[model samples]
Target: MATLSNCFQPLKFSPKRHRFNSTSLFTRRCSVSATINQSKLDILLDSVKWDDKGLAVAIAQHVDTGAVLMQGFANRDALASTISSKKATFYSRSRSKLWTKGETSMNYINICDVFLDCDKDSILYLGKPDGPSCHTGSETCYYTSVFDSLHSSQAEGSKLAMTTLQSLEATILQRKAEISESSTAKPSWTRRLLLDNKLLCSKIREEADELCRTLEDSEEAPQTASEMADVLYHAMVLLSVRGVTMEEVLTVLRKRFSRSGIEEKRSRKLEGS
Candidate 1:
């Protein structure tokens, strides 16, 4: 009779040599990817101390949208592969293997931003995702399916800018879609304009040009609040269309706002305005 080892030669010897200790350190990754740039990554990775377990936390989101897509963990090799391949990959505790997110889902989004938490143990991703991140066809890992977020005064205090932006964008997109599919809404000017992609595109361009003009008209004179609001709203609409978020745009604005108004305005002129 053959020994048991003869039937399972590979498993018999390899288990001893590998000495792998399994744990409940499972990572849930997004079906889509978000990028973490070298600069933000430099700060994050440098702050974290990987233990003997060789595991670190990573939170994935859409690159352009800044939606929290999924969360995962990384070993040294997985981190390297994520940056090297420029794709989201994670070490799966349940499966006890390395798995690239979206391999089965076919909705893998590319990376746009990677960030490290203050402690550096956690990583955050911001990117444009393709479709649902969860296997069950949910949009996010958290299954808090359908709750009212807008028009609640209490929510206003707790709203994250990005979260609010995401919600608003979704609402706008849905309404725009509804308007598009309706044949009897032609009498409604706003509905008609929203339905017409070309018209929307033109409005976006016009607002962009107006913003530029307002910025250059005079350094000391800020545009009328109405004009500014128009520009901002239209820009947000365009951003939603492009699968970007107001959060990312605000990040740029925050950086710009840090400088003296005159200094910032002058710098733009210096760059061939």
Candidate 2:
């Protein structure tokens, strides 16, 4: 049996805290303390009963979103690398060697934590992906649904089955690529916006004003939501044009999570001054 203390140590505080002013305590990157017992790693590895081919089932899950990114198998070395490097690594059964996720695609997964199932036969890796987890360019490996009766209903609900921002970002990237590849590619509103920065900025302003109007009509929740979506979409377009990712924006938000809104504002003011 492996204990948390034996496996890893708590994160150390940085001497320069201002560098992490926007980041939350929980979001702070931690180092695997030297105190971690080598015997503990051996104990964990020994607990797993690998298949005849010397592999254990490993599932990669999104740390924040709780989405299952992908599944693979891990040999002893792969598993050890994953733990030590804090990156997802698995054994490629076909290649008969260890493979690190995102090595070729640049869509690496940063592992936050790891877990073992009750049966101790399977491993779960919780991580944040740098880009699309699937080779097909989808956010997750399980994008297609074979039998999803609730899909239609879920689409109408407040919470979407898939992340709207991620989908929109992927679409924006595709449109940008298409436009770059061929000028004659059917002109899309998004493509046009991406090409003309001034027009995109204007559209964002227009959408933001419309969203503000919708907010005045508190009773019209659906209208407000629609207007807000338009604002978000345009904002995303601007971000895409600037070669900024949604993840980068989310990282800023994550950093501010631990601070009060007023404190954050004051800090910004101080910094500007």
Candidate 3:
């Protein structure tokens, strides 16, 4: 009898035939690739506490932002294929085939690492998505909240609700894009800041001073938080104007986390020297 690992060979499903009704099945290429030890992978797959259907919950999360992108089910083959391909692959229970996340839309999640939960029943695919993960063109799939879905006045709940920093960065980018396209449209505060360099610099200086004062004057927690928000907003506006992404900033911060602040500053100084 074939072992459980031998039973689930990763099926190369054609997205054209599976996702859409088309005559020709087009081949797509992914940028990421990897290889895993078969023996080790088989042993790990056998250890997983899969449900009766031989599937476990797999969640894809943004590597930089830690935002949950999408959730699906995966079997042994899906997991193995994900490791080898370096792209998130799921077992479509309905289609009964391997479904790579971005085969159709080209919004593939390029996985950096795979992690197993404490219970060994769930898997996490830590990755960076190339584009919007949701079918509705939102950044991530978990944008809608249960409370907002039921209580909001709008028929459809907000699909753009994300973490505060991600949301603010997106808003700033949107303002910049809108300002670029529509010259006559009324500008928002963010737009005005993008347009006027002197005003933006002044605002940044003002917010930074206020934020410092909050600590110096022993202001309330709320006041300090408010001042910090203003400073972050202005700084992010400057970043956007310079065409620098939040991801780049976050990547630098993440790198610095492995070292002391003094060490990081010293390295920067050395580079400048």
Candidate 4:
């Protein structure tokens, strides 16, 4: 009778309560990040010297190839939006509104960073283009040069637009692509090298030896440069075959630049371990 009375007593339960909602936490973190970004944008915008029309000349340049892609005018909103979104934006004089590049064409000029000239009147948008940056399907808008057009002695639109190493790598990649399409086409030296891994490696070794010998033999500067160029070209071909980019190699080198050679080697060994 006593146990029955105790059992019949009111039953109480306690449920654990969560202190935070996942969705709300995420929203709060996003809000904080947005606030910090806004503060930075505000500081940057205040530094630019906007003209009477509230516009500044903005020039877009290729981040990789160092080509001047295009030029436009950007108002405060356009500049702010560009920094926020990391897309090249401009204030169209005719449209009288903000227009982002590639909004309609889908060939975006992705901004990597922005620079202000000494005068602070002009802005440089260092970026990479998805495709041809010009409306006429040209790689860059400033393709035609008055000096080059008038002078016949100078090579017209030289292939030197891209840096030597990058240009060589590009050519190697192009040769790789063309090999499959045009099997019957005349086999180039690069094509032969790509087809034969052994030959490519052998050439790289041979060129490297020659490069070293230039110093050993006390060769002239031109001879050393020639040998070094051969070594670089062959090494770049090997890089292309491995599907590695020059930028990737440069990034690793850049990381090592800040550290001593011995320290860098030790770090690599530790990483390997």
Candidate with maximal lDDT = 3
- Over 1-273, each residue of candidate 2 has an lDDT whose tens digit, in order, gives 111122122111111112222213225442232444779999999988888887889999876556688999998888888888878999998989999999999778887678888987888988777777778666677654433436454432122134555656666777777886997887677777888898888887887887787767664888777777777778887887787767667666665766689999999999999
lDDT agreement with native, every candidate: 0.54, 0.71, 0.74, 0.70
Question: Ranking under lDDT, best-scoring first?
Answer: 3, 2, 4, 1
Model 1 TM-score (2 dp): 0.51
Q: Which candidate is the best by TM-score?
A: 3
- Per-residue lDDT over 5-73 for candidate 1, one digit per residue giving the tens place of the 0 to 100 score: 111111100001111211111112222235657787566455676656778887887544455768888
lDDT of 3 at 236: 90
Q: For every model in order, what is the number of clashing pairs?
A: 16, 2, 0, 0
Per-residue C-alpha lDDT of model 4 across residues 85-106, encoded as one tens digit per residue: 7789999999899999889887
How many backbone clashes can be found in candidate 3?
A: 0
Alpha carbon lDDT at 139, candidate 3 = 68
* TM-score, structure 4 vs. true: 0.60
Q: Give the clashing residue pairs of candidate 3, or none.
A: none
Q: What lDDT, from 0 to 1, does candidate 1 have?
A: 0.54
